[model samples]
Target: MHKTLEGVQQSATPAIRGPLQVYLVVLALGLTVTAPSRLAQVIAAAVFLGLAIDAVGVRPLRWLAVPVFFLIPGLAIILVTTPGHGLIEFGPLTITQGGVKTVLDTLTRSGASIIVLGFLIASTPVSTVIATLRRAGLPSVLVELLLYVYRAIGTVFVEAERMQTAAKARVGYSNRRAKIRTTKLIASTLFLRTIDRVTHLDEAMRARGYAGKAPATAEAESHGYGLSIGILAVLLGVRIL
Candidate 1:
């Protein structure tokens, strides 16, 4: 059973500094939004691409698909509907010069922003993100809410997945009606279980000393500030330039 016991052990992840990562994220987002020229936007895009490939690695493409979904629709709708003189017409569809420029500008800005933000998310742990939010003047209630939602969602998923798997084993979802009924049952069951779990958690917290406030979160490593500040300065400079 040595192999079984080994499989049960939780592994650790490398520590990333919380505040520094958050700072860079804010800077990257700010610059991405405010970048004055195409060249500046290109620079931001390059930074995002470089960060994804070098630091975040495999997650960028997968995460990027989410934003691209909305972005593509926005581009298509704008190009077809916006009224302007210069038309690049394709049958019933017509895109004006202004529409094309606006769409291109939007794509560059949004795609770059999404990539950099996704890099931040893929690299940082949840605990670090919560801690950063706490320190960044977010209300304690909101911070706790964020944490609670993350935890509760996981619990809900587990319950739902278990029920789904059990139904699948019995072929309870073999047909369309069966699938609909099973899904509703699964959702309702998950909702009830989540409420029960929250009640138990509340009691447990009262037993230990949770006086309606969130617990104190930890600070980031001392060394990360200088590097993070340097990065922020560069972004600000680029935005201005």
Candidate 2:
């Protein structure tokens, strides 16, 4: 299989509007608001804005499970823990307006951020993201680690899917007990398979004059620089005024 860093190629001339551009935009979005009230409003605005961007690229729903997972846990924990005026009561359990407020505020920002991140991940490949960072003068050791970790994630996901398919073929997950056992087996197998892959990869790298650091990448167009500035201006504008 061919390799491309998140989506950044090691070409003599890199393309405009690369993964680095998207990464910077997301970073700016994260920094826009400081207070929960305004931040929550901005987050809602961002979600709407991101939907426009999503139409032109990858929709956030392409990997709906991830956002839902984080979104649920954040609300769940905050509802029980945040202190506020009581909105409702359930015997020993109380639901306060303060708790509800905090949950909404946090979830809005968190969910909006996820929307932006989801778009970036879905549109760009992992290799391109790491490669772009490497080009941005990141430390060699850090870049190498990022590269390996991204590859490992892809490997694990693929392995898990394959095992899941195999299990289904054998009626391995027909019941809850069977499903739990199958899941445990898949996790263990995936771990061993990843370890084996890493060992061979190290050997291959060493054979090819592998060092602690990766080689340098080529330059890309600065076209996205202007685009990023405009986006930041817009985001900050909404947050400030």
Candidate 3:
């Protein structure tokens, strides 16, 4: 996670302040949810995707595939299960026009929302995000917990990579059965290791007079949002009028 974040930080465009990014994401999501037609949803998705690509290049778009892949099963169910004028009949199942429309609508909305979130995460630093959340009235305890989880993701990913490399060196994934066993071993071992690490971390924090409050990080000041605000207004106008 940290390595990926470092790559994001190297992007050509500087990210806007976290609060502005949050507002942009929220507006994009609102437009997506209340979109009157599929065309409107597509426009919303396209605009935000273009923004994301512009800010961080194409690196972050790869994460979109994960959600899209997971949506396939649900979208397929909607395609086959929803009743309407039949588009196709195959093996006692009928794909309907209405079902197809529903699927497209779902896809567009999900794509738009995900793109907005991806852009926000890719552009903003984690500390800025935490500060934004705190400013938005999130409880300190929840924020602190979230911060720990965010940091832990990097640790877990690093450990997983190291384990996978070592396993590969030992022919851990040489066959199908071996692959399954190796994955299980890695997961179990990772869990135990994470627990140990967390225990030590807790001890370290306590030793340093850790408190229940979240540590304060300097928040990025808002600036240069005129263009973004104008673009967002135009998009909203397109959606509404």
Local distance difference test scores for all models: 0.63, 0.57, 0.70
Task: Quote the lDDT for 85 in model 2.
Answer: 80
Q: Give all TM-scores, in the order shown.
A: 0.60, 0.58, 0.67
The runs of at least 3 residues in candidate 3 whose Cα sits more than 4 Å from the true structure, single-residue gaps closed, are 1-3, 10-12, 138-218
* Residue-wise C-alpha lDDT for candidate 2, range 1-241, written one tens digit per residue: 3323233223212222465554564465465334335554465446535543543333323332333533565587778767778777777677888888777777666656555544444444554566677766778787788667655644554555567779999998999999879866775566788667777877887889987665544224344566566666666666666
| Model 2: pairs clashing at backbone N, Cα or C within 3 Å | 5-127, 5-128, 6-125, 6-126, 6-127, 6-128, 6-129, 7-128, 8-128
Error of 3 at 102 (Å): 0.6
Task: Indicate which candidate wins on TM-score.
Answer: 3
lDDT of 1: 0.63
C-alpha displacement of 125 in model 2, angstroms? 2.6
Q: State residue 64's C-alpha deviation in candidate 3, in Å.
A: 2.1
Q: Which candidate is the best by lDDT?
A: 3
What ranges in model 1 sit over 4 Å off? 1-16, 59-61, 140-219
lDDT tens digits, residue span 80-197, model 1: 7878876778888788988888888888888777766655555555566677777888898887786676456444534555666799998979999998787666655667877688
**Which rank order by lDDT, best down to worst?**
3, 1, 2
Q: For model 1, what is the error of residue 14's alpha carbon versus the real structure, in angstroms, after optimal superposition? A: 8.9
